[model samples]
Target: MWDACPIELARPQKCAISEDRDKLYMDFAAPLVSEDLTLVEADPFQLMVRNGNQTCTIKYTDPSNAILSKENACVFAVNLEQHVESDLILSPTRGCKVLANRNETNLFSLSHCEKHQPHEESHFVQIKPHNKQCHTYCPESNLTFEGVNGKCPNDVWVMPMNTNFKINDVQFNGSRISIVHQETLDHVGSMKANMHLQSSVNWISLMYEINRSQPDFKPLPPFELHDYTHYVSYSFCVVVITALSLIICIVGKKLNNLPQSD
Candidate 1:
């Protein structure tokens, strides 16, 4: 009947890639969710964290073929999707700044993609280190202390006995903290619920998550410590001592001027 129509071939065309190396990605920390919800599982979507060892892809190929619609398909409506997860894999040990992973020798030597550590040419003793003020200290024992909400690092439990609404028996178990809810002043052991904890490092976190809406939950300000030592401001303390001394002097003089009895 008829010889097959002449075979047709599509020509190969190279994708044009243009890149500006100036752009860079930065770090972000999402706010921690509340304790009422538990994160049984994460998205399982691995996102890359950028650091000094890697550079942005100075080049990428734009895919050749573009799909278009019969109507409303124009240059303005076009969106290009690329495989952005592609990245260079560096050794787990290389360019790591973590103190445990890399020792002082390595950490101190790291440039952090900068030119060099400050005063690299000078002796270590010559550099003055940063000084931070300590909120708590013991002069007798020569011990320096750091704390949050007036609680020492060793005693970090948050007790909620004094709130307008009360939370009871806050207990930690298996990546969760559970507490009872009560409206009255006295502690109640009846109601209990758990909140999810996302992560922790050196410090304990108060931020947590719960499964359902926790209407009773409210974030409170940092604990206010009391001055049990009967502390007065320096100026007021000085004034009180001076007044007492004057009164004592006057009374002693009056008594001494009187008859010299036993």
Candidate 2:
């Protein structure tokens, strides 16, 4: 007799499909744990990018937020030629003038109403001493006798003199008389000495009287000379006089003795 009907076919097994689904989930989860991940905000001033072997810097005036936020971004280089213009020329009338003198040169005249201009047409006046008073004849002589006197337009009087005059030495020869005057002026102005010969002794007397009238020009304190040669000469004179007197006395004595013999 044949086997009753056929043995019930076993249901297709679902375990293999379940095992495949679980393996797919594990593979996706493994990548998430092993891969490197980073999150950072973008900076407005700087940009960074990765090159083949090194990092490059990108600088730009203004950049979009999207570009800055992108990972590995760089700034575009700018050409300055298109952005710059030529320099402008400024006129002289735009500046200021502080101090000005009128007696400097011909160009500088006394005009109070004239205003100073800057870059256009400007003139500078400088007052400089011409050393006209300094005597070039004898610098090493140290006998400077000169003074300066001038008047400004504003009625200002400038009397420049050498206050350092001193009598270093005096030589009185009939023909060539020399007197040394040493002096230093307050400012580095000019110095000069004037000498006049007078035939009339009255001029000298007048000068003496005038000098006497001025109390400030009085004679300085006397200076004593302690010369050894002078003292020696005085002692020598005294000894010579004493020796002469003794010789005369001895002669007289001899004469008296001879008379008695006669």
Candidate 3:
């Protein structure tokens, strides 16, 4: 069971709802005929459209937790005459909106790099992506060459990985390394790359010398901290002498009071 949905078309083509409600049938009058495209629930909030080998994803934006219904789902109708792989087409329904495609450029690459003089240690390069968003994503597969620091090879292409999806600066080396802030995306110097190569041996030697010659700063307490060594020794001697004198006096008194044992 299906209801008529509003559809806007740039050219002449008829879109009809299927009986099963899982597919959208597109009919091109006369000689041009195409197969039905199926739409299935990919997840709770996502729908996948299958047009032979090609599949396009659609996300449900409604805030409410409603089941997949005809009101919110649509299939993208792309090229059909050549039977070329296109996004899915689904049965139409009321209150549906059509999203049209436009010409959007997605580019990512290091435009240029050079060192002015043969003996110059500093090199200037230009990094370009279609936009700042692409710059954030290009570093992952582009940015630094293979190997670390001085050991990098010249001929090797930037580390390879899957770059099929959307490109953004954060998706690239952001995880592995720091990325430029959003505010810097529009800065004039954003594309400038200044690389200065330093000698590892010299760096290590300098660090070692700095560490060895560093002055050791010890923490000192706030109080004066008098020793009191003589006071302690004298007090201990007085206690011992007093104890001996008391013992002697008690012994003498006991002897005198013995009452002539004889």
Candidate 4:
């Protein structure tokens, strides 16, 4: 019974306990807390219940930010002892610095409990682009750019696109530049699927249900414009001067060759 495992501070006002032959189930009424309540640096909530000599512990947790290596790849250092359902929420607002859930989307979710190296911080998950030299940048004028073959770090997202939150479209010269116009859901979905296939961790899945109304945004293109006006103008002037000089020489030679006429 839940009475045996008393909850501290906030007790369940309404609870139901059911039991089958080999298993037991319990349901309780409790106010839901916002996932954003937890700070990125802070440890997660751990609930402990004691029944005589035995104790049961349950943790409500989220994953920390994956560290960026010198190679510019994301290396997630995970404590193997942590065996709880965790969500690695990614957000463009938070950039690549923190993994806080404020305005975040669930990029990876882990539910299975498997014993791994205990107590030590091990390299648990690594997500990197196939080509480190290649970076994806949104050109200033357009919303659509080439997608990185693999996940690459952006200002906010570790991946090329956020799974849920849509970044604001660039407004240039009274026109909206948007990736939603150039890229389809199917294209992004296929990318996420391919990452899962190439992924080494089997317990995690790209499980975030993207809201159709607020579609995910591809990263904004970096502000870039190439103009050769100076070079072109200089070349044009040089050609004109050269042609005029040749015409003057030909005219002077013709005058010199012509016989003087009264």
Local accuracy of candidate 4 as per-residue lDDT tens digits, 1-262? 2342234423445544455556545555444333322212213222222223322232324343222222222233332344334633322232232223332433333333223333211122122222211122221112322332332222112333322212223222212323334422233333332332232222222222111112343545787544686778889999999999999999999999999989
Q: For candidate 1, what's the RMSD?
A: 30.2
Q: How many clashing pairs in candidate 3?
A: 7
- What digit string (tens of lDDT, one per residue) describes model 3 on residues 1-262? 3322323322447888888899988865332222232322211122222222322232322211111222333332222333323433433344322332212211111222222333121121112343323222121122333332222122212322323222221123423333354332322221111001110123243333333333452445676545686788889999999999999999999999887855
Clashes found in each candidate (C-alpha, N, C closer than 3 A): 12, 7, 7, 5
> On residues 50-131, what C-alpha lDDT tens digit does candidate 2 reach at each position?
2222222223222111111112221121222222233111212222222222222121111121222332111211112112
How does residue 179 of candidate 2 score in lDDT? 28
lDDT for residue 218 in candidate 4, whole number 0-100? 53
Clashing pairs in 2: 92-118, 92-119, 92-120, 93-118, 145-192, 146-192, 164-183
lDDT of each: 0.25, 0.28, 0.32, 0.33
The candidate maximizing lDDT is 4
After superposition, the stretches of candidate 2 with alpha carbons farther than 4 Å from their true spots are 1-201, 206-223, 227-230
Candidate 1 residue-wise lDDT, 109-218, digit = tens: 11122223333221111111111111221111111112112212221122232222111212112123234543232111111100111111211111122211134557
| lDDT of candidate model 3 versus the reference | 0.32
RMSD of candidates 1 onward, in order = 30.2, 42.8, 26.2, 25.4
